[model samples]
Target chain A: MIPASFDYVRATSLSHAIGLLQDDPDGNKLVAGGHTLIPTLKLRLASPALLIDISGIDELRGIEVADCIRIGALTTHAELLASKPLREVLPIFHQAADMIADPQVRNRGTIGGSLANADPAADWPAVVIALKGELELAGPTRRRRIAARDFFVDIMTTALEPGEVLVAIHMPRPNRGAKFRYRKIRHPASGYAVVGVAATLCLRDDIVSEVMIAITGATSRAFAADSASTHLIGKPLSTENIAMAASLTGEQAECLSDHYASADYRKHLVKTEVSRALASLNGA
Target chain B: MTDHTEELHVVTVDVNGVRRTASVEARKLLVHLLRDDLGLTGTHVGCDTSQCGACTVDIDGQAVKSCTVLAVMTSGSSITTIEGLARGGGALHPVQAAFHEHHALQCGFCTPGMIMSVRQMLGQNPNPTESEIRHGLAGNICRCTGYNNIVRAVQSLASEAPRHD
Candidate 1:
């Protein structure tokens, strides 16, 4: 499938890339790691007049821990899988990266690109939402920080404005007693989540101090499993509380009905995955 | 649509250790530029959508799906295709040799992508477990072989001399 004709510009730097977008009246699209955008372009779903290639900008590719563990927007999934710091500090992220599409896709796909694409079935959204990460955006005028909960507006949409690029993601290290888990029902072909859950619990003496549960794949955007989270917090690690929390899996998120899975099936997954994730926490 | 406002630009990148330049349509994909313009058909295009990993290539020491990358994006970078894997005098890379020796391939349509993927897998971790091999090759789908010998081929190649250099 040949893509439709469009202009191409390899941006030399971050400012140049943003400037390219700001100046273009006909609308230009940013291409970083192109796994998401290129496929859409090839399908003729999007035909922009200008494509600002930002993947060449080296400043946007890394993961380092400073005040917060910062993940550069252009950090490839393969890079994350290979990062020793990520493996040591946050092994769960590495696990999710391992489960992403395949080696080739991981080699080219970027975390920033994935977040910006905002695929509801994507794994990062659930993790990011559950972790309460911050997305730093470099827009034409200024840089701003958006919470993961606010960043995703809908399926395939984000809070990014025109001429804005997601620079990096910020994840502060989890506090002591933090227990985390990520579970997903993977689509056989794309390896995307049919329904995914990321659970983080801070347990103090067998009672939950803080709990965060994020649901993806069953909704237009990942969201807090508030009902489930509320049910588990301040409660003992028991079957009753776990069940109460697991039942809140997709209460808020609208389930999608498609040829792949019915809405009922996805709702069932929401319940089952939440329960399984909770069970793992209890076993641990 | 007659009055155009923008000018298409030309960019050059090193491919297979050879300096190749092409005056391409601004929207041309790197895979198309490699196969159509430069006539490097060894880099097959099974899925232009980037799902199949058939157009895998190494850009600046990293395996990337060529179909999703723009030719203009690779300017000033070195690219290695399946053609570049075998060096002077046609000495097969250990991975390529292992693939043949293990009969890892069947239809051979996905051979180039599969071979490239194995190189990436072994390059990152010299000794990957069988499960790691399966997970690594998941991006490069092969309807043939059921992936048994391909995993063996990668397992064998991982123990051999590094495919690079």
Candidate 2:
């Protein structure tokens, strides 16, 4: 399926790309790995008049596991899977990347594009939300960061403003004692998450100090399971508490239904996956 | 600063051992560029949507579905298709030889892509177990619905002394 005709420009730098989008944001779109954009174009879901290719911009690529974790928007899924330091600091990233499509897709798919695309079933949003990450956006005149929890607005939509390019993802390095896990039921064909649940729990003296439970692919958007997180905080990380926390995620939102899965089934999977993910973090 | 003026762009890719160039429209996919322009037809297009790995190729030492990439985007990268897998002396690439020895192909339509993906899979993990090889082959699908022999072929190559090729 050949995509619709469009002019393409390889942007030289971050500012150059944002400036290009500023000219005609509606008619122009940014292309990093083109894993999602190309498919969207081929499906004729979008036919931008211009594509500002940011793949060559060297500044937007890397995984830095410093005091604060900073991931350049253009870092590929393969890069994430290969980063020994990133795996050591936040192995949840490796878990998420491992469950993504196949090796070939991972080689070309960028985490920035995945998050910016905001596919409800995309694993990055849930993981980022659980990790308490922030997204850095660059526009023609200014730059700002938005929390991942609030960045995703709806299906295939994000808080990204017109002419603003997602430049990087930021997260405070997780607490040394925090437990991280991402568990998902992958759709057999697409390898997309049927329902993905990510858990990041920090235990202090056997009580939850910080906890986040985020669910994806079950609702109109990836969302933090706030009720579940609230239930887990200030509580022991027991199997019973985990099960109760997971149960709250089922009714957290009215799940969306498609030919692949019904609303009830997805809701059920959300609760099940949340329980499974959180329970895994209880002891180890 | 990028030139947003032109509709046609020039791309140069080193395919196999040869550097090939083409001036193509921005919408032209890399698969079309290879199959239509350079005539490296071994990279099949089983599904153009990037799901099916029939169009798999090595781009900068990574397996990528050509259908998903714009030809113009890979301006100076090195790409290798099944046609490029053989050694300089025309001996079959170990992957191809393995497949041949294992009788891995049923219909042979997905053979090229499978071989290419396996090459990259092994490159990343020189010694992969059966489960690992199966995991790595998640991108390629045999319409014939058989992967036993293909897995065996990869197992044979993986168990051999790691080759630099």
- Who wins the lDDT comparison? 2
DockQ of each: 0.54, 0.55
- How high is the lDDT of residue A130 in model 1? 88
The sequence of per-residue lDDT tens digits that candidate 2 reaches over residues A140-257 is: 7788999999999999999999999888999998877888999999998888999999899888998999999888899888999999888888989888898898788897868999
The per-residue C-alpha lDDT of model 2 at residue A43 equals 89
* i-RMS, each model, one decimal: 3.0, 5.1
Q: What is candidate 1's lDDT per residue for A20-114, written digit by digit as tens?
A: 98886346888888888878878888888778888778878789965578999999888888899777766668878878887777878899989
lDDT of each: 0.83, 0.89
What are the models' TM-scores? 0.93, 0.96
Task: Name the top TM-score candidate.
Answer: 2
Could you tell me which residue pairs clash in candidate 1? none
